[model samples]
Target: MSRRRVKPSLYISVDIEADGPIPGPYSMISLGAAVAGRQDAGGFTPADPEEHTFYRELRPISAEFDEQALAVSGLDRDRLCREGADPAAALSEFTAWVGEVSTGAQPVVCGYPVAFDWMFLYWYLIRFTGGSPFGHSGCMDMKTLYAAKAGLPLRAVAKGTMPRHLLSRRPHTHHALDDAVEQAELFANLMAWEGPGA
Candidate 1:
């Protein structure tokens, strides 16, 4: 006489800044995440992304870094070297925060192009925290979601191609937290959209 429980999906918008192409050689210099919303049988319920967010600038794991990659974030690695958070503690805190925000729901991370962000995050989570709050497959790509919903080819779909209404008003600052919040708004908008011709 017992019924099954269905956990809702808590969509988290995450963005990271790294110093090189991959995780092992490079390090995740910064990480930012915002609770975009939750989804269940009743559909999506958007959150105030600003209300629940996390950001951390981490110390470099290695001495090697690509200058071009470092320039994009404009973060002072020298300063980070002296003052940034330890990778293990930072990721542990991140895991705790994700757990707190995702209580009663499943934490599912989403990013503009999720592959890159997920790559760095998953690697760091396992390397530093020993695991991920999102498990192995709890992820969604905003670009791919938009492509599927809007019926456009994935390669041709970019922020510029999307209808203005679907885009967030927030500027795409290179700052991790800023971009995470911006993407949260975009995620909410996309979730509610019925797509073109609907």
Candidate 2:
């Protein structure tokens, strides 16, 4: 009997809901990711993890949390303190989890507006781990890709133009996991439509 070999083309889609924009100055309240790859000949890749692989809230490092961001994400500071993990510990666990999921494959970490999420995560990972396993460069920003491919202005690619099913039914929620899933869904749809060559 021949053993079947797994061919993994893994990619990690990540999102971070932060207290504000500036990385070190602001705080990241929550983080989420959806790992995707084709299995065997045919199987559905999930946007949300079957077993909740990557999702975490972190205790705020700064004294101030952005009111607007908090309103959008609805993550109470008290709740974060009570439920979230320490920053360093969370990064370690997340990185370890990424290693497990990718299994030696350096999965692409993607985001809707990857600049914001990538900046915060890259800073956090470097601060905690001295460096990130995912290289410093090479992030896939869906917004930029869409703009370039669709020949649409960046402003036109707002939340409204993005597919509705991808986003939460509720109003604009800044929760990291929710946004990450939404972005991943959008990316999947785009790839399906354009057939990777695009």
lDDT of 1 at 198: 74
lDDT values, one for every candidate: 0.97, 0.72
What C-alpha lDDT, on a 0 to 100 scale, does residue 96 get in candidate 2?
87
lDDT score for residue 147 of model 1: 98
> Backbone clashes per model, in order?
0, 0
User: Residue by residue across 131-171, what tens digits does model 2's lDDT show?
Assistant: 78677984778787767666778878876775554444433
Least lDDT summed over 10 consecutive residues: which range in candidate 1?
A: 128-137
Across 3-71, the per-residue lDDT of candidate 1 in tens digits comes to 798999999999999999999999999999999999999999999999999999999999999999999
Off-target runs (Cα >4 Å) in candidate 2 are 1-9, 38-52, 162-172, 195-198
User: lDDT score of model 2?
Assistant: 0.72
